[model samples]
Target: MTDEHDWAPDACTLPTAERPLRLAEFDRLFRDAVRDTDRPSPRRLRLRLDDAAEPVVRDLIARESACCSFFTFDLIRPEGDALTLDIRVPPAQVDVLDALARRAAPAPRP
Candidate 1:
């Protein structure tokens, strides 16, 4: 599986079997992709997925971000067979995250 950070940019595809892709697979892929060497960001992550997390496997758009105190999700692509992980990190902790992320992010691709 390709570790594409921009879930929106990289269109999700269905893995051969039945539905889309396993949620666990998505987690493994993304977690590996965003492996922070220094320390894991203190973001209150939540996967507010529309698809039923069950029998039917589906591709997931797992979010990893920093945001406002309470984040309200709007189902922009409800019909789309993809999981939505609305990652929300307290804004109060932005600066600390910036410092950490800057140091953690892979060297900018020229």
Candidate 2:
């Protein structure tokens, strides 16, 4: 069994209405990452950041991508010189999101 305790945030913390809109935004962001790529893996979601701050987001992204990790999902809000990735899962994306994310981030076909 997996640790069941990755770094991804709890989805329960978000208010109901705010969650959906954010998911939509996140969906758009994720789609843009692997756009016109190839087949996506069922366990990954690529976040397209306007400013990922180099190595910082990459580390967080790695943490979230670990297997059986619930905390892999995060919300990135960038303003001025600050960027915050609020780790939380949306109910809509719980398990299904991963597969859909793969569809969003596809691998290039040969």
Candidate 3:
């Protein structure tokens, strides 16, 4: 996993010391719950997650929003038990979104 500081932008209000912990949280979510990923636009990312991940996803996004107000998160329930999370940022924050997309990407099968 990349260092916590690598993708975090200066606008993040989260304290420096807590950055790693936050990054770990995201990594955990990405590694365990993310089923697929899609980039609808430069500033938008979509994550398809297992139905069981809804609670954790909600909590994580809430906390992330507290620190990174520039982010816009939407949780959607599409037919059955499917869950989708859409995240958006301003044009200036496309790089941050790009970094997140990289992290959320599934690892290649050996």
Best by TM-score: 3
Candidate 1, superposed: residue stretches over 4 Å from native: 1-77, 95-110
Q: Model 2: clashing residue pairs? A: 8-71, 38-106, 38-107, 38-108, 39-107, 64-72
Model 2: per-residue Cα lDDT over 1-110, one tens digit each: 11222212343344446545544544555544433322134444444444544354555346335532555555454556333333333454445444444434544669
> How would you encode candidate 3's per-residue C-alpha lDDT over 1-110 as one tens digit per residue?
24435688888999979988998999999999999999989999999998898999999999999999999999998777469999999998888998899999988879
Reference-based TM-score of each model: 0.23, 0.34, 0.92
Q: Which regions of candidate 3 fall more than 4 Å away from where they truly are?
A: 1-5
lDDT of each: 0.35, 0.43, 0.90
Clashes of 1: 0
lDDT score at residue 13, model 3, on the 0-100 scale: 94
Candidate 2 has what TM-score? 0.34
Q: Order candidates by TM-score, high to low.
A: 3, 2, 1
Candidate 3: worst-modelled 10 consecutive residues by lDDT: 1-10
Q: Please tell me which model should have the higher lDDT, number 1 or number 3.
A: 3
Q: In model 1, where is the ten-residue run with the lowest total lDDT?
A: 64-73
Model 3, TM vs. native: 0.92
Query: What lDDT is reached at residue 84 by model 3?
Result: 95
